[model samples]
Structure formats: structure tokens, C-alpha cells
Target: MWTLVLNCGSSSVKFALLDVQGGQVRLSGLAERLGSAGASARVEVDGARRVVDLAGGSYAEAFAVIAGALDELGVRAQVGAVGHRVVHGGERFSAPALITPEVLAEIRACVPLAPLHNPANIAGIEAAQAAFPDAAHVAVFDTAFHQSMPEVAFRYAVPGDWYRQHGVRRYGFHGTSHAFVAVRAADLLGRPLSELNLVTAHLGNGCSVCAVQGGRSVDTSMGLTPLEGLVMGTRSGDVDPGLHDYIARQAGLSLSEITAALNRESGLLGLSGLSNDMRELEEAAGRGHAGARLALDVFVHRLAKQMAGMAAAMGRVDGLVFTGGIGENSAWVRGAVLARLAVLGARVDEAANAAAVRGQSGVISAPGALAALVVNTNEELMIAQQTQTLLAEQKGVQA
Candidate 1:
């Protein structure tokens, strides 16, 4: 069976074709800068790659391009299912859902909670439905895995009405990544996921750390929104609530503008006054860019602080699994974070750390130290497998 995993952003579409039976990704690509003059798709089909210009295409057009690419690769008709990445499921969905009118409506109800992400998710789901009408379309939520978080770990120390009426509580993001890495970490450590207490950090442009105890997310750094986690490529994570009010009164800025700045104009970009790319920051930091160095320091320290907190949520640390772009590629970042995590007994082997980059997974910790492993995240594959599981359940029900 083949599955198509689709992740739709406001202006981009990321897709992967997985051979579910073969247990491998057959194709993957990204269509970015949609609704723009320079819109294009960078596609990888069976180890071969190419770029196709969309020439100012809409979201629907982007989906069309993706579907057309799959068709050219002769895998379109073989697509058994389509798994869509829906960012915020809120409290309504705790597992991957077979998308129906009712499930679609439930997802819509979550739009208010994720104004920036859910709308685009809906757009992708709707477009993928139209493109692959014959295939099963399932929604794999980013918030679903963290739904296991206990109340004490998720609840904010705020008013009850705000949480009861407005749903103002922690709903961590990057759940699929966290859940995927937890199991992978267990495999690397030669332990069962259900027997391990792990802290999995998904450190990309947007970063989050999760406390996985016995294969369930007990707690995570991100709360309610992705903006509440570690310092990201462009997001200011964990600011004092008073700053919002103070900045509003002093700078004469509206609450929305302040939020927009925090979400877009902050983090490494704001601190370095340069780029949000971690590779760029590392290079600039090496060349004596004080701002870049500060950004890296803050990012590393904040990550270590959160990792330590996540470890505190569990009984014992089996391993600290690093995934995502920065986690997988940056050896310096791994070393820096591990250095500060001495309290957690984290000690990295420099050779293993350097050798773990470029999508290779390895044990990076020193001999007999707390296990620090780099596990490459395969979210699309995770979505595909979840979609397949739901399909099997549906078949059993029908029979």
C-alpha cells in the first residue's frame, strides 16, 4: 500500500509518498512560496530530484502540482491513502482521524485555537481531498500525542474560566516528531519505549522538548501555542506575561502587533539582526558576530533548561533524543547543550557527536554516561503508518 502524507502551510505544501508495505518513503517534496511570483516546488522522486516553477499558483494549484508530480512518477493511481498534517487538534482529537464531514467540522472548531496554522491545515486537507478523491484521507494531528499530558503538567496557574471557557492551557506542538523520536530512541538504546523515560527535543526552526515517560508524553516545553517553547528561528519563547502589557503601554502597540512581532520578528532573527538559519548563525558566530554568538548561547541554555525540566517530569532518564534540523545537524549545538546538561549526567563523545550529522543516527554520549542519541525524525512516515492503521481498523469494522 502507498500513502501520501501532505503538510500544508499558509503558503506552502510539503508532501511525501510512502510505500506503507515496504516501510520506506518513495518520494518527498516541498512546494513553497505559493501565491507568489517565485512559487516553485523542489521535489525528490526515488532519489532523483528537480524543481518546477508554479508561476504564481494558489494553494489549490500547489496541490495540483504535487498531484501532477506524483502522476508523472506513476505513483498517483497507486496512492491508497492521504495523511494530512493538521497542526492543532485542540482537545477534540487525541488520535489520527479518518477525515469525514464530522471530523472536518471538529477540526474547524479548533481554528480559533490555532488561527495561524489550522486554517492552512484545512486548506491542505480540502485540496488533498479534491486531488485524491478516491483515496482515504486521514488527519494526523500535531497536538494529538501530547494529549496524554497530565493536568498538573499542562494547566497554567491562571484563572479557571480562562481555561474552562477559552481553553487557555498547555497543548504542546511537534507531537508527531516527539512521539516518533521516543520510539526511535528506545530502539537506539536497546530498550522498549514503554519501559523508558526519555526527553525528546525536536529542535528545528520551531523548537520543543517533550517528557516521554513510558511511551506517553507526560509534559512538554510548548504550551497552548508553539510560541511558548524554546527560542526558535523566529519565535520568542517563554516571555513574561507582563512584557506584553508593558510593551503595549510604553510602545503604543496593539496586542496583535506585539504577538506578530513575537511570532515572526523575534528569536534568532531579532537577536542577531541577521538570518534565522542556524547554519548561518553558526558561521556568523564563528566569524565574531556577537549577536549570533549570543543568540546561539541563549538558544542552547534555554534548551538545556527545558530539557532539565522535562527530565524532572520523569523518574529516570533513559536517553535524551535529539531530532529536527538543528538537533540532527549541528554537532556544536549538541555539545553545547550537553555541557549545560551535566546536572542530568549528559556527557557527549566528541567523535560520535561529529559523526551523527547528515541524517545518520548514533549514540553521541560518552561511554557509561546518560544516553544522548540523535534520532532522525520521519514525521511523514509516521503519518503514513497512522493512516494505514486507521484504514485497517475501518476494514475490520466494515467486515
Candidate 2:
């Protein structure tokens, strides 16, 4: 069956059409700069790639362009279903679901918790349903995998009525990525997931750490929002609660201004005074760029400390899986984190770590090194699988 996976952001949409029969992606692309001038769609099919200037105005038009291209390519395979990567489930959805009008409205209502993501995700789902009325549309939430978190872990130490009424609790993000990587790591290690305890570090533009025990998420670093985790490309991860009030009083900055700064102008960009891209920062650091060096150091330090804490929480971290753009590609960052982790028996094989750059899954740990790995995460595939599973269940229910 053919499954099309859609991940929509504020102004961009990423799409992939996967052929589950052979477990291959038939086509993948990104519609960048949507709702802005000079929007374009970059797509690759069978190793052939092309970037086309989009005349479309909004996400709907952009998707229409993509569909037209797929038609041109003669990819006539019937799409069995479409899967969406939704950022928040808000305790309502515990697994992937068939999108109904009520389900779409619930996802829309979650826009407050994910102002920059949920609306776009909802838009994509609506567009797909409009474009392909026959194909079932599924939503696989990023917060779903962490739904296993117990009340003690997910609850905030606040007023009782607040959480009891307002849903004021932890809802970890990056669930799909963490879930995909941890399962793959277990498989690569040739072990049953139930027998493994894993700490998955998803480091990218947005980052988070997950404590996976018995193949289920026991804890995660990212709290209610993506803005709460490890230092990211632009977002400040963890911060002192008092700093907000102090900054407002001292700098005369409004709450919204500070929020914008923390969510958009901080992290690697703020620390490095250069760029948020790790590759650029790494190169600059190599040239004795003080700010860049400091940025890299801080990133690695916080990551190691977080992983160490996750290990403590899990009681025993039998596996460490690193995924995401930086985690899967940056050997220097991985080595630095692992080196600091020697305190927890997490040692790395420098050679294996370096060789892992080509996106191969392997143990980057020394022979005696306590379980460490570099696994490339395929969140789209996970979404597709969830979609297929849910669609099958729907069919069974109807049958």
C-alpha cells in the first residue's frame, strides 16, 4: 500500500510518499517559504531531484502543486492513506486515529499549546482530506508515545485545580522520533525491546531526551512545549523560572518580547553570535572562534548532563540512541557527549563514531563500552506504520 506522510510547519510543509510493499520512499520533498514570497517546492523521486518555484499562495495551493507533479511523474499508485505528524495530542489521543470532523476540531483547539505547529498540521490534514476524499487520513501525534508517563512524572507541582481543570501538565514532544530510534536501536542490538532500557537523544533544530524503559517512555526532557528541552537551534531549553520576571524588570522587555527572544533568537545563535547550523558553528570553532567554541561546549555539556540524569532515572541505561540531524551526523558532538559520559560507563569507539556519519546504524561504543549507538530516525515511516495500523483496525471495526 502507498502511504503519504505530511509534516506541516508554520510556513512550510514536508511530504513523503512511501511504498510499504518494499519499505521504500517513492518520493520526498519540502514546500519551503510558504505564505511568503519566493516559495518553492523541492522534491526527489528515484534519486532525481528538482526545485520548482511555486505560484501557489497558501499551503493548500502548494499541496496542489505537489499533487500535479506526482501526476506528471505518472505515479498512479492509489494512496491507501495519508498520515500527519501532529505536535500535540493534549491527553486526548493516545495513538494514531482516523480523522473525523470532531477529531480535526480537537486538534485545532490544541493550537494554544502549540501555536506555531498545530494549526499548520491541521491545515495539512484538511487539505489532504479535501484533495483525496477516498483515502483515510490519520494523525500520529508527537505526544502520543509519551502518553505512558505516569501522573507523578507528568504533573507539575502547582495548584491542584489548575491541573485538574486546565491540563497543566507535561506532554513530551518528539515522541515519534524517539519511538522510531529506540525501537531500531533495540533491533540493531539484536535484543528484545522489553529487555532494554534506552535513553534517546534527539538533537536537532528542536531537541529532547527520552528515558525508555521496557520499550515504553518513562520520562522525557521536553515538557508541555518544544521550547522546554535541550538548547536548540534557536530556542532556550531549560531556564530558571525567576529569570523571566527579573529580565522583564531589568531589561524593560515585555513578556512577549522575552518569549520571542528565548524561542527564536537564543540557543546556538545567541551563544555563538554566528549561526544556528551546527556544521557552520563546528567549522567556526575549529578556527578559534571564541563564541562558536563556547556554543559547542555548552551544547555538549548540557546534553551530557541531561543524558546522565536520564540514565539515573532509568536506573540502568542498557542502550543510548542518538538521532536527528546533529545527533546522526555530528561525530564531534557525539564523541564529546560520550566522553563526558564515561562517568556512567558510556564510552565511545572514536573510529566507529566517525564512520557512523553515513547514516548507518551501529554500536559506536568500544567492545567493552556500555551500550551506545547512532541510529538514524525515520519519523515519517513511523507515522506511515501507525496510519496503516489504525486504518486496518478501522476496517476490522467496520467488518
Candidate 3:
């Protein structure tokens, strides 16, 4: 069976057609810069690449282009199911769900929790459902894998009524990536996932850490929303809850303005007063840019601190697995984080750390150190697997 995975962002759509039986991507593409000048679509299959203009297009139009590309590649007929990546499942979904009208309504209800993501996800889901009505449609939630978290870890310290009434509590994101890497980390260590404890860090534009025990998420850094995690490219990670009120009173900033600043203008960009890209900050830091140096320092510090917290959650950290763009590629960042974790007996082989770049996965830990590794996260593949499982279950029920 072939599963078509669609990851819809605010302004871009990433897609992959995977052969679930063999775990291979038959085709992949991206449609980006929607509703803006130079909107475009690019597709690659069988080692061939093609790009087409989709200027000033919408998600619906983008999907139309993607469908055309699939047709051109001659794989449209092979797609047996369409898997949609829904960012927030709240406390409702613990696994991938077969999409129906009720399922779509539930997804729509999550828009408030993931205002910036769930709506886009719903748009993609609606578009795909319409485009491929004959095929099974599945909703693979990013929060589903973290739904196993115990109440002690997920509940806030605030009023119980707030959580009970408004559904306000820690619902970790990047669950699919965390779940994927935990299993992969176990495989790399030649151990069963059920036997190992791991602290998995996903460092990219958005960053979060997870503590996994016996293949289940015990604790995670992100809470309620993605804005609560480790410092990210443009999002402020952990700030005092009172800071919002203080800024509002002192600076006369509106709630929306404060939110915009935290979600867009802050983080490395706000701290460095420069680019948010880690590569750019690293280069600037090398040139003795104080802001860039400070930004990197703060990021590494927060990352190490949060990772230590995750380790505490697991009681004993058997291994540390790094994934995402920064985690996999930034040797400097990884080395610095590990250095701060020396008290935990975490030590990385300097040469190995430097060599594990550009998507290469390996054990970067020094001999006898507690298994620090670099693992590439395959979220699309994970979604495909979940979708396939759900579809098979649906078929069995029908039979």
C-alpha cells in the first residue's frame, strides 16, 4: 500500500508518497510561498526534479499543482491512502484516526489550541479529501504520541478548573519525531525500545526535548503549545508568565502584539538582533559579534538545562539522541550541550561529533560515555506507518 503524507504549514505544503510495504518514498515535493510573489512547486521522483510556477496560489491551488505533478510522475494511481499531519489532537487522539465528518469536526475544534497550525492542517485535510475521495484519508496528529504522558507531568500548577473547563494543560508537540527517534535510538544501541530510557532533543526552527521510558513519552519540554519549549528560531521558549502582563502595563503593548513578539520577533533573532539561522549566528559569532555569541550561549544554556530536566524526568538517562536540523548538523551546538551535561557523565568523541554532519547518523559519544547519538528524524515515514496501521484496522473492521 502507498501512503501519501501531507504536512501543511502556514504558507507551505510538504508532501511525500511512500510505499508502506518497503518503507520507501516513491515521490516527494514541496509547494511553498503561497499567496506571494514567486509562489512555486517542486517535485522529485525517480531521481528527476521538476519545478512549476504557482504564483499567488492558495493551498487548494497548491494541491491542484501537486496532483498534476503526481499525475505527471504516473504515481497518482498508486496512492492508496492520504495521511494528513494534524498539529494538535488535544487530549482526544492517542493514535492516527481515519478521517470522517466527525473527525474533521474534532480537528476543526482544535484550531484554538494550535491557531497557527491546525487551521492550515485542516485546509490540507479538506483539500486532500476532496482531491482523493476514493482513497482512505487518515489524520496523524503530532500530539498523539505524547498522549501517553501521565497527568502529573502534563497538568499545570494552576487552578484545576482552568484545565477541566478550558482544556488548558501541557500537550507536547513534535511527538511523532520524538517517538520516531526514540525507537531509532534503541535500534542504534542494539537494544529493545522497551528496555531503554532516552532524552531526545529535536532542534530545528522549533525545538523541544522529550523523555521516553519503555518506548512511551514520560515527559516533554513543550507544553500547551509549541511556544513553551526550548528557545527556537523566532519563538521565545520559556519566559515568566508574568512577563506578558509586565510588558503590557509598562510598554502599553497589546496582547496580540506581545504574542507576535514572542512567536515571531523573539528567540535567536531577537537576542542576536540578526538572523535566526544557526549557521548565520555561528558565522557571526566567529567574527566576534557579541549579540551572536550571546545568542548561541543562551540557546546552548537553555537546551542543556531543559535536557537535564528531561533526564530528571526519566530518573536515569540511558542515552541522548539528537535530531532535527541543528541537532544533526551543528557540531558546535551539540558539543557545547554535551559539555554542560558532563556532570551526567555525557561525553562526546570530538572527532565523531564533528563528522556527524549533513544527515550522517552515528554514535558520537566517547567510549564508555552514556550513548550520545545523532539520529535523523523521519516524521513523514512515521506518519505513513501510523496511517497504514489505521487503514488496515479499518479494513479489518469492515471485513
Candidate 4:
């Protein structure tokens, strides 16, 4: 069986075709810069890469081109199911769900919570449904895993009416990535995930840390939105709530303008005034660039701080798992973070840390210390697995 996975964003759609039986990515592609003149898709089929120009910026246009490409490449006909990555499922869904009309409406209701993501998700789902009309469609939510969070961890210290009338509480993101890496971390330690307590740090362009207590998300850094997490490529993590009103009064900026900057122009980019890419910043810092050095320092410090808090939430740190782009490739980052985690008994083994870069996975912690692991994340595969389980549980041929 094959699962076609779609992770749609405001300006792009990432699609993948995976074989569940063999656990292979038969096709992977990204259609980016949608709603722009430079719209295009870069696809890799069976390990060969190619690029194709798209007709327009609309989701329909991009997916249409992709569908045609899939047909030409002879990969479309084998899709047994379709899995859509819905960013925010709110309190409605705790697992992958078959997309029914009522379920679609529930996803629509979450648009307000994820104005920039859920609508694009809906768009991709609709377009994929049109493209693979005969296949079973499942919605895998990014917030579903975090639903296990207790009220004390997820609720905010605000007015009761705020949460009662509107959905204004901590709804952590990056559920798929966290869930994927936690299982991998358990595998590395040769332990059952349900018997281990780990802190999973997903360090990518968008970053978040999860407190996995017994394979369940007990708490997470990203709250309500991706912007609330660790210092990301362009998103500030843990800013003072009063800063919004303070910036408005002092900087003469509107609420939306301030938010836009925080979501787009902040984080390592804002701190360094250079690039958000960690590799570039590291190079600049090595050249004694003060801003770049400061950015890296703040990133390491803030990330470790969040990791410590998450470890505290779990009450024990069996393993500190790192995944995503930076987590998988940056040995400097992994070592720096572990140095700060000494209080939790995390001591980095230099050779193991250095050897774990560039997609390599290993135990980087010193002997008799809190285990530090580097695990590669595969959200698309996890989505496919969830979609497969949901489809298997259905009666007759779900497609």
C-alpha cells in the first residue's frame, strides 16, 4: 500500500509518496513560492530529481501540475490513500481521522486558531481529493499528540471567558515531528517509549521541544502557535506578553504589524541581522562577528532553557533527543546544548557528537550520564503510518 502525504503551507505544498510495505519514499517533491510569479515544483522520483514550472500560485494549479507529473512518472495510480497534514485540529481530533463533511467543518473551525496554516491545509486536502478522488483521505493533525497535556500544563493564566468564549490557550504544534522522533529515540536506547521519559527537541527552521513522558506529550514549548516555541529561524520564542502593547506604544506599530515582524522578521534573523541559516551564522561567528556570535549564544541558551523546563515537566530525562535539520547536522549545536544540560547530567562525548552529524544517529552523551541522542525525523512517514492504521480500521475498501 502507498500513502500520498500532503503538508500544505501558506505559500507552498510538500508532497510525498511512500510505500508502507517496504518503507520507501517512491516520490518526494515540493511546490514552492505559490501565489508568486516564480511558482514551481522540484520533484524527486525514485532518487532522480527534476524541476517543473507551475501554471499559477493557487493550490489547485500547483497540485494539478503535480498530478500530471505523477501520472507521467507512473506513480499516481498506485496511491492507496491520501494523508493531509492539518496544522491545528483544536479539541476536535486526537488522531488521524477520515475526512467527512462534518470533519471538514471541524477543521474549518480551527482556521481562526491557525489562520495561516489550516486554510492552506484545507486547500491542499481539497486539491488532493480532486487529484486522487478514488483514494482514502485521512487528516493527521499537528496538535493531536499534545492533546494528552494536562490542564495545568496547557492552560494559560488568563480570564476564564477568554478560553471559554475563544480558543486562547496553549495548543502546542509540531506533533508529528515530536511523535516520530520520540519513537526513534526509544529505539536507539533499546527501550520501550511507553517506559521512557524523554525531551524531544525538533530544531529546524521552525523549532519546538516536547516533554515525552511515557511516550505521551506531557508538555511542549510551542504554545498556541509555532511562534511561541524555541528561537526559530525567524520566530521569537517566549517573549513577554506585555511586549506587544509596549512595542505598540513605543514603536508606533499596530498589533498585526508587530505580530508580523515577530513571526517573520525576528529570531536568529533579527538577532544577527544576517541570515537565519544556522550554518551561515556559525561561520560568521567563527569570524568573530559579534551579532552572529550573540545570536548563536542566545539560541543555545534559550534552547537549553526550554529543554530544562521540559525535562522538569517529565521529572526525569531518560534521553534528550534531537531531530530536524539543525538537530541532525549541527554537531556544534548539539554539544553546546548538552554543555548547558550538565545540571541534568548530560555530558557530551566529543567524538560521538562529531560523528553524529550529516544524518548520522548516535548516543552523544558521556557514560553514566543522561542519554543524549540524535534521531532523524520523518513526519511524512509517520503521517503515512497513521493514515495506514486509520484506513486499515475501516470497513470494506476505504478508498
Candidate 5:
């Protein structure tokens, strides 16, 4: 059976078609800069990439174009299911779910928590469902796996009524990626997941640290929204609540305005006054750019600090797994982050660390290093697995 996975953002959609029999990606692509004149699509198949120019259009149009392309290429193989990466499933969805009308409605209602994300997520899922109506639809939430967190970890120290009535809590983001890497780490180590403890750091444009104890998420960074985690490419993580009011009064900015700045205009780009891409910042820092140097230092500082705390949360780390773009390819970033964890025996073999760059996955630590690993995150594959599981479960019920 094949599964098509979709992760939709505010202005872009990423897709992958996987042949789940062997867990391989048969095709993948992105429709980026959508809803704008500069919109375009890039598809990769058979290890070759082709870019298609797509003018300003809706996600439904993009979906149609993709489906039409697949048909034209005579690659319209029947799919067993479609999995969507919904950003917020609230407290209701604790696992990947086959989408019913009621499930779709619940996703739609959670838009208030993910104002910029859930709408696009729903659009992508609906479009894919329409495009492949015969296929089962599954909602694999980015928030679902982290729902296992304890109340003490997930709760905010706010009024109980606010949490009870407003759904206020720490619903960590990057849960899908963290869950993917943690399981992979356990697999690579040849240990049953329930016997392992892990600190998985997902460092991308957005970052988060997840403490996976016994294969379940015990705690995680990011709270209620993606903006509350570790320092991101442009998001300020863990800022004082009073700063919001203070900045609002001082700058005459509203709460939303402050949030926009933190989520969209801060992080490395804001700190370095250069770029959000870590590669760009690394290059700039190498050129003796003061802000860029400081930005990298600060980024690594916060990232490693959070990793240590997460390790502590798990009591001891069976493995420290790093994933996401920067974590996978940036040896310097990984080395710097690991350097700060020497106290925990997190020693990286420099040679192994360097070789792990460029998407290679392996042990980057010394022979006796207590905990360290580089695992390329495969959220699409994880979503595909979940889709297959749900489909198989449905089949069993019918049987």
C-alpha cells in the first residue's frame, strides 16, 4: 500500500508519496510561495528534480496540478491512504486518527490555537481527500505524540479556570519530528523503546527539545504554541510574560504585534542582523562578523542548555538524538552544542561528528560517550506508518 503525506504551512505545502511496503519515499515535492505571484512547484522523482512555475493560486489548484502531473506520467498508482500533518489537534487527538467528518470538524475548530497553520493544514487534507476520494484520510498531528506529557509538565501556572475553560497548556510543537527521531534512535541502538530514555533536539527554523522516557514523551519544550520553545530561526523562545505587557506599553504595540515580531522577525535573523539560514550565519561568522558570531554562540548556548535540562528531565539520557536541518548537516552546530554537555559525558568524536554532516546518521560520540547520536528525521515516513497502522486497524474491524 502507498501513503501520501502532506504538511501544509501558511504559504507552502510539502508532500511525499511513500511506498509503505518498504518505507521508501517514491516521490516528494514542495509547492512554495503559494497565493503569490512568485509561486512555484518543485517535484523530485527517480532521484531527479524538476521545477514547475505556478502562478498565484490556491492549494486546491496545486493539488490538481500535482495529481494531473502524476496521471500524465502514468504514475497514478492507487493510494491506500492520505496522511496530513495537522499542527494542532487540541487535547482530543492523542494518536494518529482516520479522518471522519467529526475529526475534520475538530481540526477546523482548533484553528484558534493555530490561527496561521490549521487553516492551511485543513485545506491540504481536504484537497488531497477530494483528489483521492477512494483513499482513507488520516490526521497525524504534530501535537498528538506529546499529549502523553504529565499534567505537571503540560500545565501552565495560570488560573485553573483559564486552563479548564480556554485550553491553556503546554502543547509542544515539533512533536512529530521528535517522535520520529526518538523511535529511530531506539531502533538504531537495538533497544526496546520502553527501555530507553532520550533527549531529542529538533533544531530547524523552529526548535524544540523533547524528553522521551520509555518511548513516551514525558515533557517537551514549546507550549500551547510553537513560539514557546528553544530559540528558533526567527522565534523568541521562553520570554518573560511581563515582557509582553512591558513592550506593549513602551512601544505602543498590541499583543498580536509583539507576537508577530517574536515569531517572524527574531531569532538568528534578528540577532545576527544577517540571515535565518544557519549555513548563512555560519559563513558570516567565519568572516569575522561580530553579530553573526554572537548569534551562533547564543543559538548554540540556548540549544545545548535546553538539551541538558531535557537530559536532566529524563534523569539520564540513553541517547541524545539530533535532527532537523541544522542538527543533521551542521557539524559545527552539533559540536558546539555537545561541547556544552561535557559534564554529562556527551563527548563527540570530532571525526565522527564531521562525517555525520550532509544527512548521514550514526553515532557521533566517542566509544564510551554516555549519550549522543545524529538521526535524520523522517516525519513523512512516520506519518506514512501511522496511516498504514490506522488503515490496517480499520481493515481488522471490517474483518
Candidate 6:
């Protein structure tokens, strides 16, 4: 049976059709620029790529285009389940849920926690349900994996009422990627996930680190939202709470304006005063750009710092796993970050690090050093697997 996984953003939808038993991607594509003049859908199947115009379209139109493409490709009858990636489940959902009216209402209640993401996610879930009413629909939450965090790790040093009344605490994001990479790391090490302790770094446009012990998340970098962890492509990771008041008083900037700058104009872009892309920053630094060099330095330094903290959470680190764009492709970044972690016995083979790039997976640790690995993450595949499992459980219960 094939499971359809959908990741809906504010203006785009990424999808994959996976053979659940074999764990193979049968069809994958993206719909971009939805609800705009440039809207289009691109689908890849059977080693061929096709693009369909969806100009001035909505999610419904985008789904139609995908369905039409599947029909043309003769795989329309293969879909058995639909998986929707919901960004935040708040404190409620701890696992992938079969979508019912009650579950849908619970998801709707989480809109306030993820104002910019959950609404789009809900829309995608509703649209997919309509498009495949016969198929079982499951909601896979990004926050689900981190629900294993203990109270001490997730709580803030704030008034008890803030957490008790508002649900304000460290509800880590990137739980899917973190959980996927942790299991992949265990596989690469030829060990069971429940027997290993790992620190996972997911470095991309957005960055987060996770500490996993006995196959469960103990601590993660992101908190309450995606903007609270390691420095990212645009979002400032961690700033003193007082800085907001300072900026407001000294620069005459409104709270909203400051919030926008921190979310959009900060991070690598703000530090380098150039591009947010790590590739560009690295190139500029090589050419003697002071700001770029500083940005890279700060990024590496902060990442290493957070990684060490993750190790502390696990008490002992059996391995270190790197994923996402920067973590997988940038040999320099892997080396730089690991250089700081030598104190923890984390040392990478320079040659092996160079060889592990662009979706390549391997152990880059020097002989006898703590195992360090580069594992490519597949959040979509993970979601599909979870969806398939949930559907089977539902069927068994009914039977």
C-alpha cells in the first residue's frame, strides 16, 4: 500500500507517495506559489518529471493537479493513506492521530500556538481528506517526538502561572527530523535505537539540536517556537529578553518592528549583512569578508555550545549525528563544529568528513573517537511510516 505524505507551508505544498512496506518513494513533487499567478505543480514519477500550471489556484486546485498527474501515470489507485504534517500539537498530541472531528477540533485549538503554520496545516489536512475521502487520514505532529522531554528540561525559569495558564514552555520543533536521524544513526552504528545515546544536529535554513537517550527525546534546542534555538538562516536564535525593551527604548522601534527584525533580518543575514545562504557566507569569508567570517564563527560556536549541552542531557553521548542541508553538505561546518567538541572525545576523520557530503551517509569519526555520523533525514518517509502504522492499528481494532 502507498501512503501519501503532505507538508504544507504558507504558500507551497511538498508531497510524496511512498510504498510503505518497501519504504520507497514512488512519486514526489511540490506545488509552489499557491493562490498566486505563478502557481504551479511539479511531479516526479518513474524517473520522469512533469510540471502543470496551477495559476491563481488554491489547495483544492493543487490537489486536483496532483490527482490528475497520478491518474495519467496510472498510480491513482495505489494511495491507501494520507499523512498530514501538523507543525504544533501543543501539549496534547503525543503521537500520530487518526483524524476525526474531535481531533480536528483539537488541532484547530492549537492555531494560537502556531499561528503561522497550523492554519496552513489544517487547510492541507482538510483538502487532502476531501481529495481522498476513502483513504485513512492521519495527522503527524512535528512536536510529537519531543513530548518525551521531562518537566525540568521543558520548563522555563518564569512565573508558574505562565506555564500553568498559557502553556508556555519548550515545545521543541523539528521532532520528526530529530527522531528520524536518531534512528538512522543507530542503524548506521549497527545498534538498536533504544540502546544508544545521541546528539543530533539538524542544520539548514532553520537549525535545531536534539538529545536522545534510549530512543527518546530528552532535550531539544528549539523552544515554544522555532525561533528559540541555535542561530538560523534568518531567525535570531536566542536573545536576552531585555534586548527587546532596550531596542524599543534606544532605537524608538515598536515591539512589532523589533519582532519582525529578529525573525526576518537577523541570524546569518543580519550578521553578514549579505546573504542568508551558508554557501555564500562561506565563500565571502574565504574572500576576506569580516562580517561573513564573524557570522560563520558565531554559528559554529553556538552550534557546538548547544551540542555540548545536549550531551549533558544524555549524561553520555555514544554518537553525534548530523543532518539537514548545512550539516550534510558542508564539510567545513562539520569539521568546525566537531573541532570544538574534541573535549568530549568527538573527533572526525578529516578525509572521511570531506567524503561525506551531499546526501552521502557515513561515519566520519577518527578511529577510536566517539562515533560521529552523517545521516540523511527523510521526514516525509518517517511520516508515511507512522501513518501506515496508525492505519493498520485502526483496521485491527475495527476487525
lDDT of 3 by residue, 122-207 (tens): 88888888888788999999899899999999999999999999899999999999999999999899999999989999999999
Superposed on all Cα atoms, the candidates' RMSDs to the truth, in angstroms, are 1.1, 1.2, 1.0, 1.5, 1.2, 1.2
What digit string (tens of lDDT, one per residue) describes model 2 on residues 1-399? Answer: 788899988889899998765679878999989887788989888779988787765787777866876686676347878899999989998899889989998998888888878988988888878777778889999999999988877988989898878788899999999999988999999999999999999999999999999989988899888888689999999998788999999999999899889999999999999999999999999999999999999999999998988888878989888999999999999999999999888889988999998677789999987889999998999999889988888889999
Candidate 3, 56: how far from true, in Å? 4.1
lDDT comparing candidate 2 with the true structure: 0.89
Give the Cα lDDT of each candidate.
0.92, 0.89, 0.92, 0.91, 0.88, 0.92
Model 5: lDDT equals 0.88
Candidate 6 lDDT, tens digit per residue, 1-399?
778899998889999888877888878899999878889988898679989888666999889877876787687777878899999999999999999999999999989888879999999988988888888889999999999999999999999999999999999989889999998899899999999999999999999999999889999999988889899999999999899999999999999899889888999999999989999999999999999999999999999999999999888999999999999999999999999999999888999999999779999999999999999999999999999888888889999
Give stretches of model 6 more than 4 Å off. Answer: none
TM-score per candidate, in order?
Answer: 0.98, 0.98, 0.98, 0.97, 0.97, 0.97
Candidate 1 structure lDDT: 0.92
Task: Tell me the tens digit of each residue's lDDT in model 5 across 226-306.
Answer: 999688899888888899999999999999999999999999888998889999999989999998998899999988888
As for lDDT, the candidate ahead, 5 or 6, is 6
Alpha carbon lDDT of residue 362, candidate 2? 87
Model 2: residues >4 Å from true position, as ranges? none
lDDT of 4 by residue, 1-399 (tens): 678889999899999888877788878899999989898889988798889887666788877876776787687777889999999999879898999889999999999999989999998888888878998899999999999999999999999999888988898988999999999888889999899999999999999999999889999998878789789999988799999999999999999999999999999999999989999999999999998999999999999999999989978889999999999999999999999999999999999999998889879998998999999899999999999988787855655
Q: Which regions in candidate 5 have their CA more than 4 angstroms from the true location? A: none
